[model samples]
Target: DASWISNGNVNGLGWSLKDQMGSEYFGLRACNRSLSALHAEMEGLLWATSCMRDMRITSVRFETDCSDLVDMTTNPMEWPTFATEIEMYQRLQEDFEDVSLSHILRSRNGRADALAKKARNRGYIFSHIDQTRSYGGVLRRIGSYIST
Candidate 1:
């Protein structure tokens, strides 16, 4: 699963692939440079692919709030703004046996959303890192299950 949070000039991207037992392997990156929402979503997709490859995950479902992204991935072409990233994502998809991308409501993606927000607020860059409590109280209040 992937989530993206953006506030004006900052974009926070986060993704987690979990085992059946709910042990999450996740990554987060904060983009200090401003990017369009589509571009940011593409970046999140790239990160998700890298994570999936590193974990040796052959079949997986990716859930995101960006329906446009899901559509774009389904039919990739030379989009004026997101062409490069979209192409890269398409190439990455070929490496997996079953790559299912779905559009989900933001409210239903709370954990990943919270982590993205935390990454934006804290200026975090973590590749395959454990979940941490950097913003434990605020995240808990906002219904994020990130542990201390």
Candidate 2:
């Protein structure tokens, strides 16, 4: 549920700039770091969602694996956010509900400690998960379900 790691610089140059974190594909990078694989990060997102579902929770926290997801989800009406396939986009939008998303250090992904079980070769060294919010406002409606 929590993860953090010191990621390295851009182009192997120096440490990453925190403010630039949200702009990248992954979350924020740490200084003096290693390459973070994209597939692993994506897997992390998938696992988190699964774990939340297993908990019987409609609302759950998630760490971003890419700003792409964030930028897309936030723009509900934007054309690009729709994934070009109407049915796919509609399904994705529904799944996104109750997803309280945010970015975190890779070290904090407890379940991810198992190495994402991915081949090291197929990875994305994105320095940032670029965390953000998702699937908002589910709890406010809980009262309606409770019934007076």
Candidate 3:
């Protein structure tokens, strides 16, 4: 769960950045909402922070196409209505030693985006095909699995 939730834009992983939440981040108005959400980065950052705060760790190398959020999270610069956003992000990022920012293309964010959308529509009341877990145990260590 921890790994899947925070796994950034990686090959065959989830969509990076604001796209991370997948379709769950949208609704019937998905198309328009997605574009509107793109106007800023802090929105997702805040949500991610909410999801990650229990780990008791800080400092992260955050990346995304949403440069506005990257700037707001790391630069301490003022953004319109940014204070609230930072409050959450700072809480999450504070565990890190250094929070670097990286920008990547949107194509890399599809899997996670799909998962997010699925979660939103289904209320996350069922098993996940992604094998996502919350206790950082989702990713099975090599040689630890076998067919019974």
Candidate 4:
């Protein structure tokens, strides 16, 4: 998973799973009660960190539309509630030779948003569609939303 987008309060988190070529291969959405947006964001990041470790991805760039999250993860700022996540992210960063985090405009995060919306509308927390045979159309749609 490379990026995440959260649906409304009732819904959950949507994440984009991409391959080495930067082509989206799967979309994962999950719900957990008693968690705020911040928690979901952290969870998504944590999930991505774990996946990267499992896939042995040592060099990676993570993009998020949430500027606050980017700041928190990239800076020394911390919140009492987010302490755990902050530490986890920091530790994860340490394990990598090169890991970068950046903030992107929501408009440029259309793929993640689209996946989140699909999850919300369908009331499904998880869905994975192999794009090897039909990624062209999705990529085209995503191209318009990602700014150069």
Q: Tell how far residue 43 is off in model 4, in angstroms.
A: 1.6
TM-score of each: 0.75, 0.33, 0.47, 0.68
Expressed as tens digits, the lDDT of each residue in 78-140 for candidate 1 is 355677777788788888999988999988888777767666666544443453232423321
> Which segments of model 4 are wrong by more than 4 Å?
1-11, 17-22, 124-148
* lDDT-better candidate, 3 vs 4: 4
Clashes of each: 0, 18, 15, 1
Candidate 4: minimum summed lDDT over ten consecutive residues — where? 139-148
lDDT ranking, high to low: 1, 4, 3, 2
lDDT of each: 0.67, 0.34, 0.38, 0.60
lDDT by residue (tens digit), candidate 4, 35-95: 5666666776776666566557788887888787787776645566688789988888887
RMSD of each: 6.6, 15.4, 11.3, 7.1
User: So what's the TM-score on candidate 1?
Assistant: 0.75
Which candidate gets the maximum lDDT versus the true structure? 1
Of candidate 1, the 10-residue stretch with the lowest lDDT total is 139-148
Is 2 or 4 the stronger prediction by TM-score? 4
Give the TM-score comparing model 2 with the true structure, all chains together: 0.33
Show the colliding residue pairs in model 1: none
Could you give the candidate ranking by TM-score, starting with the highest? Answer: 1, 4, 3, 2
Residue-level lDDT for 81 in candidate 4: 68
Question: Which candidate tops TM-score?
Answer: 1
Per-residue accuracy of model 3 over 17-131 as CA lDDT, tens digit each: 2223221221110111222343323444444443334333244444565565566656766665666656666665666666565665556545445544544343222222211
